[model samples]
Target: MKTADPPRPRTRPKRPGAPGAHRRRALPYLLIAPTMLALSAVLGYPLVKLVLLSFQDMTRKELFAGTDPPWVGFKQYRSIFTDAFFWEVVGRTALFTVVCVGLTMGVAMGVALLMRQVDPWVRVTMAGVLVAVWAMPIMVAAAVFRWLTDTDYGVVNWALGLLPGADFTGHNWFANPWHGFTVIVLVVVWGAVPFATITLHAALTQVPAELEEAARVDGARGWQLFRCVTFPVIKPAFVMVTALMAIWDFGVFNQIWLMRGGQPEKEYYLLGVYSFTESFAVNRYSSGAAIAVITVLLLLVGAVVYLRQLLRMGEVE
Candidate 1:
């Protein structure tokens, strides 16, 4: 009673717009400021330059003469948009991305499921092999694949030649565009599968065994058990990996270039290779920049779609 009588003014609550409240709200941004600044410093200038370059009519002449190229707003874009070859490249890139992503995810999921069911030692051995494969440099992997598909002495051709009534000996994998792409897809899927398997295996381990057992007790089996009890838990990880893989596969250049002996034919042109060819090979720098800009825009659209799907999944969960 005496303390109540002596009690003074009540403490005031902070308003949302108060200085302390504002600082508290901004603390997260403050913590991330240095990283944001660093990224801006590294990426901002190049991006600005690229965008500017896309609006200019730059060529080797302008570049070597040390003179600013004349501005030609959207002319490069107009040219490419009207070209049938560009559309073909776009379609090819899209199809390539889909196939590579599909194979990578399928093989990875199968391997991840196998890892979960196998003996611990066997799983460890498999993981070790995957890591070795993952750790191999892209250049080395491309070189190995090139040698394996070599027309004359490739082990792949030799091994297939031994099959009854089958002859793959001296088969030029890169001779036909379809066959060349198949080999490229195999190399891409091979390199891509290990990381995807490891990530998916890690995600699978997070799924509660109790839920799986409960579903099984209710007579859920095989695909039913997975669809009802397992897939939901790992769907987020799966979607993220698939989106990233698609983006990477869309930009694939090195494998095709290397496999085609650094001068990928017109038939092998993906977006990245097409951009490079336009810029350096053809001396059409402005056109290359326009293509690069279009590629970036496409990637942004994909990213937005991925984000929306992820957010929807989060909301559903």
Candidate 2:
């Protein structure tokens, strides 16, 4: 009877699946939490606030008139569409973006490719200089350029003084909108060069040397080798750089604001400057937000196009 009672106390082995299964399930969620938190802070908060503000009245005049934010049904949208300054600024911003993006990508690609052929020391040195220029704060860039291009006592004026028979003595670089725009473009190009160069250099390295050797073995040399082998591989990289630069320039505020557009004033204002002046100077937050929204839309389109190109290139590869 005692032996039988002892036999009844037989223990079962612990299941291997339970504790490990709990860990496996929790690990994925743990990893995902940080990214989720960052996205919530970076993107979700602003979006929620923007939607709320867009729906709000946000005007003292309405409050005084004993009114709350009536659902005016796209009234602000209509006002933006009707404004002439909006169109003018949009046109100028487009032209500026196009020029800046084109120049930045073209110059940066050439420099990157050239550096790749040089010794490692030379490559490092070159990258240092380019990155220095890029790492400069945009505000600093604009200020320095303004000084360099000033009508009097500027380096440009001094250089003109050195040149033979050049009558550029008293001409302010930003006197005209076109010159102002050009100077802004140059600053933007300088700032953008590093991003394009680094991306392109990374891409160029990924171009298989064995493929180039194969082409060389088949008598492909110089331009032929690049066209057949190197170019195809790095083309998507160029597309990405170009698209990113385009979007950056389209939403530019620093370069334009630093150039002091709308100083002397409104006739030369572009969208960024105009929007800022409206929001803070004249208390037109709705209008400013609308223009900012437009800029964001343009950037979104550029990003989409870049991704699409990348997808196509992946398929081709």
Candidate 3:
């Protein structure tokens, strides 16, 4: 009773705005402030300008005259949406992206599995070759593919001609859009495979051998092993790589442009090339901006999927 009469004053809670509390809460933001500032300066400004430009009817005339183009308020977008050729380009781009992504992931998974099964020296050699391929410049790779698929005296044509009933001599790969796209696909896949392979192989290394062994003990073999155990372990990596590959392939331009000698045919126009051709080649700058904006919106879907995968992985960890 005597001690209760002298009860201690109640302890005060720390204020949210206390100097130390505030600093602790702000430390992370403070650390990231420079990065955020740099990204805003570099990326944010251009994105805002692009959106603004898409709303305006900017042409070569306006660009040359250094005058601000009149705002047309979605006219450019409407024109693009209404164009049949735009839809064709979209469809073709989508088809190309699906094919490329499919082949890339398939071949990459196969190569990764091969690497895991091969002898140590063979695996090292394969990795070295992959690294070399991965480090190659896109320009150099495109130029090499161009030479290989050249209408005359190409090594590819020469090699194909060596087959008993096949004659690829003087074959114009780009004459038929289908044939052209095949070569382009090959080039794209060749350039893409190394990265995907290496990434998948790295992911494969993380797979628990014990799990695979246990699955094998239960009579899981080949596809069953992969589908049940291996694939699940690496699924996160596979999804991330596939989404990135789809996005990159969807915007393919340099390979097509360089292969077609700086003037890709309409049939060859993916969204990126279409946007560039519209802007600089035909002086439809605002229309190009609109197309670009649309392309970015489409790519945002993949980006969202990629982000979600990362978040899910983080939560799992």
Which residue runs does candidate 1 get wrong by more than 4 Å? 1-13
Clashing pairs in model 1, backbone N/Cα/C closer than 3 A? none
lDDT of candidate 1 over 132-204, digit per residue (tens): 9999888999999988888999988999998999989679988899999999999999999999999999999
Order candidates by lDDT, high to low.
1, 3, 2
Residue lDDT tens for model 2, 1-317: 45544546657665657886788779999999999999999998986765555545456576467666555546666788898878888888888888888888889878988999999999999989988988899888988988998887788878877788887788887778788778888988989999899889999999988899989999999889878889888898878778878877887777777678435367566677777777668776666666666666767787888898899898988
Query: In angstroms, how far off is 245's CA in candidate 3?
Result: 0.9
Estimated TM-score for each candidate: 0.95, 0.82, 0.90
Question: By TM-score, how accurate is candidate 1?
Answer: 0.95
Query: Alpha-carbon error at 302 in model 2, in Å?
Result: 2.0
Better of 1 and 3 by lDDT: 1
Window of ten residues with lowest summed lDDT in model 1: 1-10
| Higher-ranked by lDDT: 2 or 3 | 3
Which whole-number lDDT from 0 to 100 does residue 235 have in model 1? 98
lDDT of each: 0.94, 0.79, 0.93
Q: Which stretches of candidate 2 lie over 4 Å from their true place?
A: 1-33, 55-57, 60-70, 217-222, 261-264
Error of 1 at 109 (Å): 0.8
Q: How many clashes (backbone N, Cα, C below 3 Å) per candidate?
A: 0, 1, 0
